[model samples]
Target: MRHDHHGRTHRLELDDQTLREWDCTVVASDPEDGLVLDRSAFYPGGGGQPPDQGVLIWGGVQTRIVGVRPRDDLWLVPDPDDPLPPAGTVVRGAVDDDRRSLLMRTHSGLHVLCGVMARDFGVPVTGGNMEPGVARLDFDLAEVPAGFKDDLTAALNTEVTADRAIQVRVLPRAEAYALGPIVKTATDLLPPDLEDIRLVDVVGLDLQADGGTHVASTKQIGRIEVAKVENKGRGFRRIRLRIAD
Candidate 1:
C-alpha cells in the first residue's frame, strides 16, 4: 500500500531515448520497501511496451531493479532482499541498452506496419503489443488481401530501406483529435482530463497518439520478417513480426 504523492516523476526517456544512464535524487522510499525517484528513464510498461529492466548504483552498492509500476507516480521495485535507499540519496540509474534498443526498433517497426496497412489496404489497428525483439498487431479486416503476407513483408522492408525519420511531439488534445483518420483509436479512448497528447509520427507514413518509446528512424529497424498472420475472428486479423539480425 503506497500513498499518492503530489509530485510527478519526470520521465527522462521520453525526450531522449538514447540516454542509458542518469543520476537522480531519491524522492521517496522505505528501507526494505518500495522506491520512487525524482526522475526516471524506466518505461513503466504502458501502451504495449514492456517495462524497462536495469540496475541502480548508490554508495558503491548496486541493486538489481526487478520491476516498476505506475501509480500516481512511478514506483521503482527493487529486489526485496536488498535494502532500499532513503529519500535524498543520489543514485546512478542505467537502462539495459541492448534491451531498450531492441524494443525501440520493434515499436517503430509496428508503426511502419500500421502505415503500410492504412496506405495500401485502408485498415486500422485494433490492438498491439511488443517485447524486446518481437511484436504483434491486430488489424480490423474482414479478410486478408491476396498475397497479403508477402506483400506486407515487402512493404515493411521498403520503408526500412527508405530510412524514414520518425518524429515525436506533444500537441493539444483538440488539435490531435482534429487529425481525424490519422489517429488509430476512437476519441473517447483518450483520457478526458488529458489536455495534451504525445504523438509519434513515422514521417509521411503514419501518425497516432502514443506514449511508448521508439527509434529515431525507420532504418534502425533493419530487416523485418512477417513471422505469422492469423485470423483471430470475424473482422480481426493478427500479424506477428520479428527483427532479423
Candidate 2:
C-alpha cells in the first residue's frame, strides 16, 4: 500500500496536515463497521496519537464521526445516534480543527523531546503515548541526572524557540534505514515487507521514520513543561510533558 493510502481510502492527512475539510463519496457503510469514504482526511489512530473526531454532512444532515478504524479498509465510526451516509452518497467531511491542531502541536512536541534526549543524553525511545496537549515518552535510561526535570523543560523550550522546520518525506525502506544512526534509534519494529517509510524530520535536530501528523515548525508547539518523570523498573524512565500556548 502507498504511504498516502489506507486500503481503499486516500489518506489526505498524510500529504496535507493542514487540510481540515474536503468532499468525497461514501464507498461503503454499515451500522456496526461505519462508513468508508473514497477520500478522507480523518487521521486513524497511530503512533501514540489518537484518531480524529469530525462530522460528515450531506443533504442537510450530519453524521458525527467519533473515531476511525483501519482494518482491510479505513472505517469511520459515527456516533451511534447519528445517521450514516449510505454508499455512493456524496458528503463534505470536516475534521475538528481544534482537536487536530492541538494534536499536531503535542505530537511535534514529543519529537522535540526525542531530539533533545538523543542530542544531549544519548537515549533511545523505548515507548511513548500522547493526547492533545499532554504526552509521555519512555527512555532506556538507567539513571536520571540531578535536576533532570527542570533541565529538560528548559532544553525543550529552547528548541521550540529555535523554531526548527519540520518536514515530512516518504523514502524507500533501505534509504530510511540509512539514517538510523542519525536518528539514534533502530527501526526494527517495521515489517520486512513494507517497501516505503514515511519520515518526520526536525531539521538540524532529529529524524525518524514516523506516520503521525506534526506541526510545521517547532515554535508552533509553544511552551513545553516537563510535568513528571517516573521510574518503571530497571532501565525505564518515563518523562511526561505538558504543552501550552
Q: TM-scores of the models, in the given order?
A: 0.93, 0.97
Q: Candidate 2 residues 1-245, lDDT tens each?
A: 78798888999999999999999999999998999999999999998899999999998999999999889999999999998788999999999999999999999999999999998988899888999999999998988989999999999999999999999999998888887653444345777798998899999988987888999999999999999999999989999999967
The parts of candidate 2 lying over 4 Å away from their true place are 182-187
Best by TM-score: 2
RMSD of each: 3.2, 1.3
lDDT of 2 at 213: 94
The model with the greatest lDDT is 2
Model 1, global lDDT: 0.84
lDDT of 1 by residue, 1-245 (tens): 11112146778888888889999988888654478888788877887899898888999898778778777768888887776778899999999888989999999999999889888878778888888889999988888878889989999999999999999988787898787654674233676787778889999899988888999899999899999999999999999999996
Candidate 2's TM-score reads 0.97
Over 4 Å off, model 1: 1-6, 31-33, 186-188
lDDT of 2: 0.92
